[model samples]
Target: MAVATQTMTDEQRKSVALEYLKAFDNAGTTSTGGSILDLFAEDAQVMFPKWGLATGKKEIGQLFTDIGGTLTSIQHHYSEFTWIFSGSDLVVAEGTSHGEHRDGPWRAGVPEWGAGRWCDVFEIRDFLIQRCFIYLDPDYAGRDTARYPWLSQD
Candidate 1:
């Protein structure tokens, strides 16, 4: 982990948050997985509502890597994402990520594709993100599969 001795301020924290939004914008239709790291601190961790918890930059990176493999690449458009500043060292942002399949798991379903929204709580430190907890529902994927003949239930 890189050590940053600079004091973290609200302005710096907010500015750093933009990188996360930028990462989603740059992902385009292909899930690079690595780009999302811009949002987290090197030791940052995220706990998915159903997917479980992941820690460290490398681990978090790998988790998204698997996600990239499961679904076609899609850019996350975060609308209505705002930071709730908690003592300048913490901020929580909740928003939606909507995109269409361009590669894996959800394709061949509904002919209309799918999208999801996530709620995230972030813990910030030294102008870098230290932790993030994410919540999502893959129930939509199952629903899409059962409804689309092109998708295999198996």
Candidate 2:
């Protein structure tokens, strides 16, 4: 497998992270499977909240395809991030996603929209994503934001 041979500067790491986010943002409303998968290493793995774990490109791509069918639109708006670099080969990004979801609840007889929190852990290798684990409240999207005093002034 190809490996990252050099260390990236903090600026470079941040740039790569942003690119990943951009690819993800672009993935929301369309089926640009390659565009979304291009940011990951060939053998990358992702531990998603509802969808479970996916290993390798094919599985990961399939995960996106499956989830894409359920959502009309979605976004990952990271409210905070902490990046730690272990040399140039590895980077760990921890953050909270304060994103929006539409046509959600992803099931029949459920609320149709969501705006809530997801905690994410992203591990990067050679500037490509090596692993991503997201923890979230699967039901958060179905409730009214006004019910959460922290989310609204209601």
Candidate 3:
């Protein structure tokens, strides 16, 4: 995808940045696919913190499909967002991810208390994420597992 050079105003940039984030964050709650796709440009990249990375619309669509088929939900509350514009089309979003898994506490990615406070750095192009880097504190994951005490074998 061709990155744009339109030069958005500071406010417009922030607006676009928020929209870009809402696409993914909302996916964790009420998005099936279309809602999530709305925030992406035709070519986007979606990555799980430590699992997978899908590039382009086709790949991203499949990633969403896989997410829908396997895990029941992404339930999350996004707060503490800090956004910066790299250029007209590129943006980086740093925010804490906190949520719980309702159906299965045994799940690895799912947590008991919070969503592990992750930082997702998104490379947004044309209003969608073209690349992403997910960062999460393993200590939080460990703590969540510790709370349950039945699933941690390590």
Candidate 4:
């Protein structure tokens, strides 16, 4: 595996991170004409809520497949995205999204504290993502309300 060199500028790193998001939004489609995995380094690590941590490309592919299988569609609100640069390799992106899960659909701000809101912290270098940790509620359908008294329908 090629070593990741810290040669990309902040703007370039931001661009790569954005590209990852774009590819994720267009996943399983021919629009991007490329696999999302292409944006990651061979030894890249990824973390998703409930999915734990995945190391390397092979594990990352499995992680994506697991999550993608449950979502019918997803669209990130690019206009609402908030970006933070760490003056180094770290780039954080916070945004809202609307999507269809296997059970139902969800949109950010609908019911205030539901799904759709998310934040992802990424470490980019050599024009590829070296690490990405996603933070978000996975319950798109709000079916897990039973665990929270406030969210309970009854």
Quick one: best lDDT, which candidate? 4
lDDT of 1 at 90: 71
Q: Clashing residue pairs in candidate 2, if any?
A: 7-88
Q: Residue 105 in model 4: shift from native, Å?
A: 0.2
Best by TM-score: 4
- Model 4: colliding residue pairs: none
Each candidate: what lDDT?
A: 0.60, 0.62, 0.54, 0.88
Candidate 3 displacement at residue 151 in angstroms: 12
What candidate 1 gets wrong by more than 4 Å, as runs, is: 1-4, 28-35, 101-115, 140-154
The order of the candidates by TM-score, greatest first, is 4, 1, 2, 3
TM-score to native of every candidate shown: 0.65, 0.64, 0.59, 0.93
Candidates arranged by lDDT, highest first: 4, 2, 1, 3
Instruction: Please give, for residues 37-119, the per-residue lDDT of candidate 3 as tens digits.
Output: 66666766677644587777777777766655443334334345676766555556665544333433232335443444556
Per-residue lDDT of model 4, residues 93-132, tens digit only: 9999999999899999996888999999999888888999
Model 2 misplacement above 4 A: 1-3, 28-34, 78-115, 143-154
In candidate 1, what are the lDDT values of residues 1-154, reduced to their tens digit?
A: 4566778877677666656655645551214365567667777887755567788878877776655545544444445676688885777766555444433233222334453555667667776678777666554354546666766545
Clash totals, every prediction: 2, 1, 1, 0
